[model samples]
Each structure stands twice: as structure tokens, then as C-alpha cells.
Target: MSPQRFELLIGLYGDDRMAAILSEQELIASWLKVEAALATAQAEAGVIAADTAAVIAGAAVPATIEAGRLWRETRNVGYPILPLVRQLDEALPHEHRGRAHYGATTQDIMDTGLAVQFDAVGGRLTELTDAFGDAIAALATAHAHVVIAGRTHALQAVPTTFGAKMAGYLGELARDRARLVRAREEMTTVSLFGAGGTSAAYGEHAVKVRTRVAELLSLRASDIPWHVSRDRLAEFGAACALLAATCARFAREVVDLSRTEIAEVSEAAGHLRGASSTMPQKANPIESEAVIGMAVTAGALSSALYRIMEAGHERAAGEWQAEWQVLPQLAALAAGALGTARAVAEGLQVFPEAMRRNLGADSGLVMAEAYMIGLAPRLGRENAHDLVYAAARRCRATGESLQAVLSDMVPGEAAGAVAELRPEDYVGHPDVAIEAALARWRDRG
Candidate 1:
């Protein structure tokens, strides 16, 4: 696809809320907000006069800074905080000019700004994940008895309910959501250690000022300096990556199940939705495809985040710069993927009849395990396995029904068990598993 086409598609399906939260305007605004909070906190700690802080805070709005000039100076200075502080200082009265940024380093404001952004992003993602989880829970409950073929290595293995499958997805999503919540909580702590990871410039009121600033920003205060300890942020990235990867797994399953040959499930249909350019009959799983793409992109970005953890002691030379470019994109992609995943889950179309038909596709080959397990108690496990294997071979070679071949192959004593091997009866305890998943989801909620 062309860049224009990609952008258009992304805008249509991507998480616009996340896009707005991570936009340049919002980022600059967050930085300014942090600067104002720092000034107010310093005043509270007696590092600066209240009136000076008031003047600085009044001038700390984003409109006081020029975007074009800010970028120009940022390019020259290799950081934007100084340019931002310069503009804020310029906007303040001469007496209060030097007090605009007040003992805080660039990382302090930037990192705290990120925490604010993540607070917003985390809330959005958590909402989406919960929505998706609810959808899966409903599906699992509704389809608790809907038998389907369980496959391994891309081929039919045994009977299983669609509810059980959806329960598995719910379980994975719940775990990912928990990880994201923990990471967001841990990563949202304040970053007020000065340039050298010490409060040398902050003097006696450093801890007080930092704690007050954190409180003002609605973030956690940490005494241990994190100027070089990037693990918390990386943990957040890893959580997002895991969530995206799980979304991709679900999407891939939808894509495979909705294929022309399988036709067991589909994304919701609409007029020309997911329409192919030339094939008039095609209605593709486009949203799921986009989810898979976004997940892959998030995974790749997460690698860069891990590399960032290798920053040298006390400061990152070039690694920190990459964060300005990587983190927002990574977060946006994860949100997009998750938003699309929720849509897919809520609008999914399931064909139980098709699932049943497909289960009998290879002449009841999918139920081979049912027969094996049925005879395992009568015959030894190895003997039952060999018998089912031979019967399966005969059914395949002669195009005969597995039920018929297995019925004739089983000893007379096991004839009753072979006769009872219906797919619905063979789907083991899906209701119990679905209930377990639903219980966990409720607890999370």
C-alpha cells in the first residue's frame, strides 16, 4: 500500500484517542504542565518564592512557546526542555525569569510528562481490554456447548467447544491486562533526579520538592533515582508488546478460521467492508489483518526499548533520544491493535453448522481421539492408540467413515463406547472452564 493509503486506513481503524494523547501538541502541553508543577512544588518547598512560582506557572502554558522556533532550537540544542524553559522564562517577568524550570533537568520533565501520558493511555487501553474480555466471556458462555474441531499443527486433533477456545483467549487477555496495569503503575513514578542522578543542584529541599511535584502531577514519588534505570519504562513496553502479541494470535486464529476453505467464523459484514479490489465476492478480515500488522510493529519497537536499557551509568548518551521517537509510536500501535481486537471480538460471526460440517470433513477423522480414548480403558493405551491409528489409515485410504472403521475395529466389548462418541459428548467440560474464565474476568473487573 501507498503511504497515503496506509495513513487513511490507520486513521479509520486506529485508536484516535491514543493518537490525540500522544500528539505533538499534547506532548508539548504535558511538558509545560510538568514545568508548572515543578515551579509550584519548589515554591511549596521554599526553594523559590510563591510569587515567582505563580509568575512562572502563569507563563508555562504551551501557547507561550513557539512550535517552529522550539523545534529549531531543539534541533540545535539536541533537547527541547531548555528551549521550552527559555520560552517560559521569556514570557515571565524579569524578576521571575530564571525560576521557570527551577532545579529540574530535562529528563525530569520529559519522564514525568510521559508518565502523565501513560496514565491516559493506560486507562484507554484498560477500557478496551476489558471490553474485549467481556466480549470473549459472552461468547464463551453462549457457545459453551458448541462443539468444534480442536486442531494441532494446523490439522484436526479432537473435539472441543468454541467456548473453550474463547475461554483460552480470555485467559490470555486477562493476564496481559494484569501485566499492563502493573507496568503502568510502576512506570508512572516521578523522575526528579537532576542531571547526574543526584539532587546536588536541588539542595536541601530536593526530596520535598520532588514529592510535591509528583503529588501535583498525580504520580508516584520515588527516592531512588531513575535517570539511568530505564527498566520501568521498558517493562511498560514489554507489557504492551505482550498484549499486542496476544491480539495478533487472536487475529491470526480469526483469519484462519474465516478462510474460504474453513468458513467456520467471520468478522461482521457490511456493505463493501473489507472488499477486495477485483474479487467482488471477497470480504476479507481486514481489521484482524491490521491488528496483526500493528502487533508486529509493536513487537519490533519493543526491541529498541530493550536496547535502551543498555544505557551507561547515570545517563544515556544517544539511547534516550530514541525514546522520544519510539515510545509514542509503540504505544499508539498497541492501542490501535487492541481497539481493533475489541471490534473483532464484539462483531465476530460464528457458524456452528459450518463448524460441525468441517468436523466431519475427513469422514469423522477429527473424532479419532474420541474413539481412542473410549477404547483406552478396555484395551491398553498403546493398543488403543495403534488400533485407532490403523483405523484412521484405513478410513483415509478407502475414503470410508472413521466411525464405521473404528466400530468394526473395536472389540465387541467396547462397541457401546464407540457408538457413544458424538462430538458434543466428547467436548470435555467446556462449561467448567468457561465459568472459571468468567470468574477470573469478573475478579479483574
Candidate 2:
């Protein structure tokens, strides 16, 4: 495929770094690296002479192989490693040719090589996730006291700080980041079991060779072969899906808050940053929209991984091949989603005045619960709720503040108590919750 085919779309929906890591060249190079490591490990395990291992390793570089011929022969062979082995053998001295891919099967090299690729991709993703979290934490800290209307079922329900909203995003992302980190760690394990989930080909040196290869590759070594046990790969995809969903939640909120009627928050302004071609008076939440798109696509792609896990027996009939197509795309979509989320968050424009304005949009009915609680002590709880309910209806109908309506309906003592309740004062422990969230984010270091 032409590399530039998706260039335009990639800028909005794909991650360049992730794409590079999972590219064809990188995939071939990873396979070559695995061959080299296998030779080195075999030498250490006494399966091959050290000089022979060196000769194979020297010839294992991708430059020594013909990509066109390898791929053509792979088409006929139904696998690439045999063709790759043939190329490596041709590059080697006759004596060392036989030792090139000693004791390793096609799946062994492909799976282990994929693990190496995932290591790079996972590290990049973790960095992006952490950066996004940092931006959110900063927003949370900056807006800790900036109160906005808290909405439920699309209607104003109470008072809440924008910082607390940011903190909520931070909290979910922190947990998702942890899950991704763990899944990446688990997924990066070496796949050295020979054909049929057995190490019989390696004879006495199977465990040693696998261990040495894992050490050289900086991957985990497992005691059993996962030839058909694809849970690790499935888990990684699930984690990515979860992260995308969390980011989408935050993006959805940004889109809502940036609505023309709401106008409480906006994406940063720039020259045609979110420009409309025809309508010169429009600015959109472009990054957040892309984030949502990437998230939805990632979520859909990740679900396919579960089907891949249904592969039976010692090897998959065809399910294993699905991962090759699904994992990279899933990871790329997740990276795109997270990276764009960070961009939106870092450049987010928060308007405290707009937030304050929106808080009063419902004629101060949002503070009814606060007022009801304040009056509940003097009047009975049920009576206080009934009185506030009546006051809220009048406040909404007359376009007056809840305090004004309540004062007209209640006695002097109750009116005095209701007057003391403020929207800012009723944000409900956001300071404590935000601080705790900030502490958790810091500790993720």
C-alpha cells in the first residue's frame, strides 16, 4: 500500500508514532531482531556453537533479506518465517546456515516479534496517557473553586465546580492508565514455545533458551506456552477500549459545555483552528470530536479481540491471525483518542464568569436543594422539601431567584436561614475530593 494513502485522515484519526511502530518495515525488523536474539540464546544454551550463533546473528539483519522475494514466497508457503529463514540461510556461510533459526517455529518468531513491537507502542501510549492526566490535573487544580451548574438528565440539578468535573476525568483516567500499564506488561511476554505448544524441538535447552531470549528482548518469560491461550492479547485490547471510553466521556462533556447556548467552556482560539468554511462565525470543538470518533472506532475494533480468544486446540484455526489486523489498529485508535484529548485539555478555555452565569440560568432553582437542607433543621425534613418544591416552581415561573420566592412564601426565621445558602458554598466537598485526586495523580509517578 502507498504510505501516503491515509496521510490526511491520519492527522485526525491515527497516531503517527503508533503507526510507525506497527509498520511493515518495523514488523520485518522486529522479526530479524528476534532471529538474532534466538541465535544468541541458543549459543548460551549450548544448542549451537558461539561462532555459528555470531554468523547467524550477523546475517539476521533485514538488509540482508529480499523483502519482495520473502513476501512472494510467503504467499506460497502460507507463512513468512520459512521464507525468512531461507533468506537468512542464503546469507550465511554453508556451515552456519543450518543454525540460523534453530529450534524456533514461525509462530515463535512472529509472536515474540509482535511482543517487541507492542513494547514500543505501549511505552508511547503510557507517555500520552500520563501527559493527558497531567493536563487534566492542572485544570482541576486551577478551577477548584469555579462553580458551574451540575446537570443530570440534561437539566440543572445542583452546583458543582468545573475543577471537580476535571477531577472526575482525572480519576477515571488514572485507573485506566493503571490497567493499560498492567496489560502491556503482561502482553509483552516472550512466545518461545515450539510447534504444538511443546518445546520438544529445543530438547534439553528449551527453558534456558526461552529465558535467555526473554532477558535479551527485555520481555517476560513464561513457564507455559500460550499458543492457544490468547487472554493476554485480549486483555490488552480490553484495556485500550476502556481507556477510549473514559476519554470519550470527558470529550462528550467538553462538547456539551462548548455548546452555543451553554458557552461555559471552549476549545482554545486560533487561526482556523476550528474554523467553518462557509459560516465565518463558527468555531468547533474539533479535537474533542476527533477524540470521540477515535474512541468509538477503537471500542468497535477492540471487541473483535474477544472473538480471537475463542480459538481452540493447541493453535488457532484462523483466530490468531485476527490479532495481527486488530491489535495495531486498536492501539493506534486509542493513542489518537488520548493524544487528542490531551491537546483539548491543555488548550481548554474555561470561563468562570460563564459558569457563574449558567448557574443562574434556571433562576437559582439549582440551589433549592441547598436551601431545603438549610431549612430542614427548623422545619421538618418533609415540610422543608414541600416548601422548597413550591418555591422552586414560583422561582421558575416568575424568573426570580429561589431566595426571593422562598422569602415571600416562608416566615422571617426560615427566610433568614435560606438567604445564607449560596451556590458557591453548596459545591459539596469538591476541595477535599479534588485534593485527594491530585494526590493520587501525583503518586502515579
Candidate 3:
């Protein structure tokens, strides 16, 4: 019944749990929760009767509020809190009606509601990210010694294990997880400041009321009202963008390795899951494609959030309004990217023989670096590089193997060094790196 891609067709590019967290119904429920919490805080501070606070709390459930009327009034009033407060007050008994919203302002309810939603979203994202990292660690451990061609700038440069490549990604994911955890902790704070964030209306009891509200909502109380200081939200947005970019990096690797010419890896398929319309033999990297696409969208949305950080004065005219649209989209896109990445990691198909075939395709030219390093002690560094360069050109021109060319160009110790050099021999401690990455993931768990 939703109109957006993240809602209507969420299976393709969104997580249902994340979509629900950001849904309109949930937003309204969060606002009502904030109103109830504010009433409770005021009651604790002697600003309202305890019985009235309990009555307001009992009446603040979303089911008791009329959605259609609230929507209509929100449109007429240019904000939702006024209509929401009026509706909640009407739902209360005559004696307790006035205590519905207490001394809270529109932004107080709205901002605190956002914080509640953010706490839920952050927890879900953390769980998904941990699952994805575990999958990566498993893959790395399984392929710890499985050697493959290490590509640099679209060409094979040397040898590296698949585990090493996955380890690189795992390291980035760990850092991303840490950054997101910090940002979430910082941003999920209660926003209970009064109209102008000064709490002047509450006088001496403002801090106590704020603390009580935060405690009721299970959130952190801010030292000062952050009505215009949006860096916390911006930090969370930036972390999400970084996570999406990492997912895209992993997906891009899968896409390239699964290419027709490469065929070193692919996404698992069943029936006609990844089949093309015209080409019957096609089994596309659909999950990887989705991950990359969602990552790109998240990245763009994160940049928009950064721009919206400069809310004018104590409150914004347009910047704050823009956030209401951008934040949920960013969350949906990030959740989608993480889910797609998890699928990719769990169901990846690796072809060891195909990798070996591709690694051997260039007739041992990929080992040139190893050969040059071997010969450097004997021929001087510059001379050894020059010799290898000349031998590489000759091998390419004559369709001969680099080993054969090097055999003719160098003799004795230099030749022995070249003969000893092999693709697998040049992997350079990949297992050590992989173990280190897996250990980090384990520690995080």
C-alpha cells in the first residue's frame, strides 16, 4: 500500500523490519510515547498531579488516537504535535485533559520521537552488521590458503589468497561497526528542551524533568538541548554511508570475479533465480548488483544529510524540514545494502580450478614481481628491473612464457632465483593477515 521503492517493493531493495521502524504508524506511536513521558516527567517534578500523569499515559497509546482527524489537523496546523496533543487531551478524562503534553514543545515531542525510532533502527543495524561480519569471517577462514591472482588496475599483478582479500573487507567492516556503535550511542539521546531549548518555563526543575523523561524513554539525557546542533544525526548518517560504500566494494569484487571471462566466483543460483530474459545461459550476480545499487543510493542520501547539518540559528527554516525526508531514506537504503551483502557472503560460490586456470593464463607473467625481486641481489636493482621489463616484452611479442624468456636472459644464480619463484611462493603472509582479521571478528562477538 506504500508508494516508495523501499516500501512498495521492499523485497527488492529494503528490509521489512527497517521499513516498519521508519513507517508512519510507528512515527505517530513514537510521538505519543514522548508525550506520555513528558507528562510523567512533569508529574515527578510536581508540575502536574501524579494521577493526571497516569491517566495521560494510559490514554497516549496510538490505538486511542484518531489518525484521520490528526492527519487533517496536522495539515491545517503545519505541524503534527498540536493536533496530536489536542487528540490525546480529548482522549483523557475532563479533570486530567490539560496534563497531556505538559510543558513540552512541538520540537521536543518530534525530536524525542525521532530518538526513539533511531534507537530501534541502530540496534537492528548493529545486529545485521554483526551477522554480515560473521559471514565474512567464515569465508575468510574457509579460503585461508586458496590462492588466486591478485589484480591491480584491471590486470593480474601477483598472487594472493581469497582469504586475504576477504580479510581486507573484514577489517573495514570492523571499523565501520565501531564507528556506527559510537554514533548511535551519541545520537539516541532524549530531546526534552522546552520551546526555545532553555526550559525557562520549567524554571528550577527543568534538569530533573529532562532526566526523568530520558529515564522513562530508556535514552540518554543531553547536557544541553540540541535543537539546532545536528552533528549527532549527521555522524550516524556518515557512518551508514561508509558501511554502504564497504558493501559496494565487496559487491564490485564479486561482480568482477563472476564475469564471463573470469568465472572465478559466482552467486549461487536455483531454478531461474538469476536467469536472463534473452540469454538462457546467464546466471547474473543479482544480489551483488542490488547491494551496489542500494549503496549508491545511501551514499547520495548521506551527502544530502551532511548538507542539511547547518540548521539556521536556534532552529531551522528549511534544513530541519529536509531531514524528515532524507533520514528514513538513508536508513532504508543502508538496511537494504546490508541485507544484500549478507546474502552474497553466505551463498557465494568459489571455483578454485577456475581461479588456477585464470592465474596461469598469462604464462607465468603474473610472477614477474617475484622474479625481479629474486634477481635484484645478483643484477643491481635498476638492472634487474630493466632485464625483467625487456624479458616481459619479448615474451609478449613471441608468445613465449616469461620463464622461458628469463631462462635465456639470466644464468647461474640469477636463473636459479627465477626458477625458485612461483605464484604461490609470493603470497606474503596471507594466512597471518586472515587469522588476524578472524580474531578481530571473534573478539567483537
Q: What would the TM-scores of all predictions be?
A: 0.96, 0.96, 0.97
Q: Over the stretch 1-445, how does candidate 2's per-residue lDDT look in tens digits?
A: 2234553444666777888987888999999999999999999888899999999888888798888888889888888999999999999988877887787889999999989999998898899899899999999999999999999998999999999988888988889988989999998999998898789898888999999999999999997999889999998998888888888998999999999999999998999888999999989898888888888888888889989999998889889889888898788888888888888899999989998888878787888889888889999889999999998888778888888888888877776676656688899999888998898888875
| Descending-TM-score candidate ranking | 3, 1, 2
Candidate 1 weakest ten by summed lDDT: 1-10
Per-model CA lDDT versus the true structure:
0.87, 0.88, 0.86
Candidates 1 and 2 compared by TM-score, better number: 1
**TM-score between candidate 1 and the true structure:** 0.96
> Candidate 1 residues 246-322, lDDT tens each?
99999999999999999999999999999989999999999999999989988988999978888998889999887
> What tens-digit string does per-residue lDDT give for candidate 3 at 1-445?
2244534324676888998998889999999998888888888889999999999889989888788888888888878999999888888889877777777788888989999999998988888899889889989989988899999998999999999999999999999999989989987899877888888876688899889889999999986888888998898888888888899999999999999999999998789978999999989898899989888878887877767778877777788888898888777778888888999999999999998888777767898888888899999889899999999898888888888889999967677877746677889999889988888877774
Residue 66 in candidate 2, Cα distance off native in Å: 2.5
